[model samples]
Target: MVGNMSKKFNSFKEFYPYYLSEHQNLNCRRLHFAGSCLVITLIFVAILKSSYMLLWLLPVIGYGFAWVGHFFFEKNRPATFTYPLYSLIGDWVMFKDIIQGKLDI
Candidate 1:
């Protein structure tokens, strides 16, 4: 229906499940984690390299890879579309969980 979305999140508990569902496939989740990690590293490198231009393409390099996995591998809508900020947060949280061995992908 593409109805207008509310810009408010009532709770993380509600949002986390949706986040997990959107990234259920192992490959999709792994690709997202890789993209995020690369993006963070790129940010630090950009700062060190004095190449601020790379900052402009961070979202594209990160989300482009992740979205490719979501659409091609997972065949699912990205949580980012429905929950931009929360989904961004979820990406970090999920990445942390993966690093801590609490998540597979």
Candidate 2:
């Protein structure tokens, strides 16, 4: 649920808790992590192969997987719709947390 629908966060620290709440579903978190890994791989491939065209798929891959997670798994609206910047930051932070074992799979 988007409980913070009317709440405005002035800092990422404040937004992160809400972000985590939205991603409580295991499948949603996994999809997000997988999407992030793919995004990273795609970036490296684009740079190493000099294929700037591949860079164009970044948003499609990143947001596509995330949207699927939110819609199908989380059964909630993505924070991206309302808080684009913080939500993007939250994605990376969540990825890092997952990798570091701060969050359960």
Candidate 3:
């Protein structure tokens, strides 16, 4: 687990560029984006449906796609281990970037 201090983003200004770098490969970013989307949607669904049981699978969904990207395309370990919450935040931000067409990859 990431300590709160360790996960503290000194600045999104710094973090975003690093996020972009880590997601350099188009496929990696796409996969990560998909994972983030699935996780978020499932979370909301779990909340709305009052079904907490599936919540346990959220991490698997999130990590599964992103890990595939990291291992297969990026060839790097995910920063999630070092910065779990921040990485989660970064995931959403990157997802937004993808949806907005701000990120080509």
Candidate 4:
């Protein structure tokens, strides 16, 4: 694991580049995008159906897909283990970037 050697970024602006580097693999990015889309749809379903239980699946669905991509496609440990908050933020940012054609899908 590269955990101990990881540099502490003072801001998300600095962290984002590193995050992007971790997710450079095309399949990994696609999985993340798919997971994020599922998360959004699930959130709306939970709200519309008033089924709070469905909300619980958010992390499972999101992380499951992402972890698979990291393990199989990226072949690297997920940054989420070391930087949960920043990683979550990166996921959304990357999702938007993909949508805006800034990042390849």
Candidate 5:
């Protein structure tokens, strides 16, 4: 595994660039975006159908696809392994950026 596992960021803002840097691969970004979208859709479906069980799939869906991207495409350790909170925030922010064309997948 890569080292520097203890590097700390004071805030999500400080972590995002590093997060983006790790996701430079186009396919990795696309997988992260797709995973986030599926997570959002799963949440809505769970709410609308009153099937709370579906909510359990959120982490699997989100992290599964993302891990595949990171491991196979990006070939880097996921930031989530080091910075869970900021990494989560980075996921949504990156998703929004892709949608808004601020970032290209």
Candidate 6:
């Protein structure tokens, strides 16, 4: 598993390849896509209604689906634990890539 490599990346450019590698599973990617979509929707709803509670639920909605994908489908540890900021960026980049047909869902 890539997680076992224990490599440290100097930049997001370097980390993204490893991030993509860890999420090779189709179902895992799909779950991430769904979660990201929900996150965007929830954020919009929170803004529209001025709901701080819904804003707070963002991470839960995002990570819950992502963790399920990683654990059940990908069968690998999520990069989030070790690389929180990068992992969050990776998730959205991946979501865009999938939507734009750069990555398969």
Who wins the lDDT comparison? 2
lDDT score of residue 14 within candidate 3: 64
TM-score per prediction, in order, is 0.87, 0.96, 0.80, 0.95, 0.94, 0.94
lDDT of 4 at 53: 98
lDDT of 1 by residue, 33-90 (tens): 8899899999999999999999998999789988988888888778788888888889
Off by over 4 Å in 3: 1-9
Q: Which stretches of candidate 5 lie above 4 Å from their native place?
A: 1-4
For residues 11-57, write the lDDT of model 3, one tens digit per residue: 76767676677778899988998888898899999999999998999
Give me the displacement of residue 6 in model 6, in angstroms: 1.5
Which residues of candidate 1, in runs, are more than 4 Å off?
1-9
- Candidates, ranked, lDDT: 2, 4, 6, 5, 1, 3
Best by TM-score: 2
Per-residue lDDT tens digits of candidate 4, residues 1-105?
233327898899989999998988899999999999999999999999999899989999999999999999988899998889999999999999999999997
Q: What does the lDDT come to for candidate 3?
A: 0.81
**Candidate 5 per-residue lDDT over residues 1-105, each given as its tens digit:** 343557788988887888888888999999999999899999999999999999989999999999999999988889888888888999999999999999998
The lDDT of each candidate is 0.83, 0.94, 0.81, 0.92, 0.90, 0.91
lDDT of 2 by residue, 9-98 (tens): 999999999999999999999999999999999999999999999999999999999999999989999999999999999999999999
**How many collisions per candidate?**
0, 0, 0, 0, 0, 0
Which residue segments of model 2 deviate by more than 4 Å?
Answer: none
Better of 3 and 4 by lDDT: 4
The candidate with the higher lDDT, 3 or 5, is 5
Better of 1 and 4 by TM-score: 4
Give the per-residue lDDT of model 6 (tens digit) for 1-73: 3475478889999999999999999999999999999999998998899886888888898999999999999
RMSD of each: 3.1, 1.0, 4.7, 1.5, 1.3, 1.3
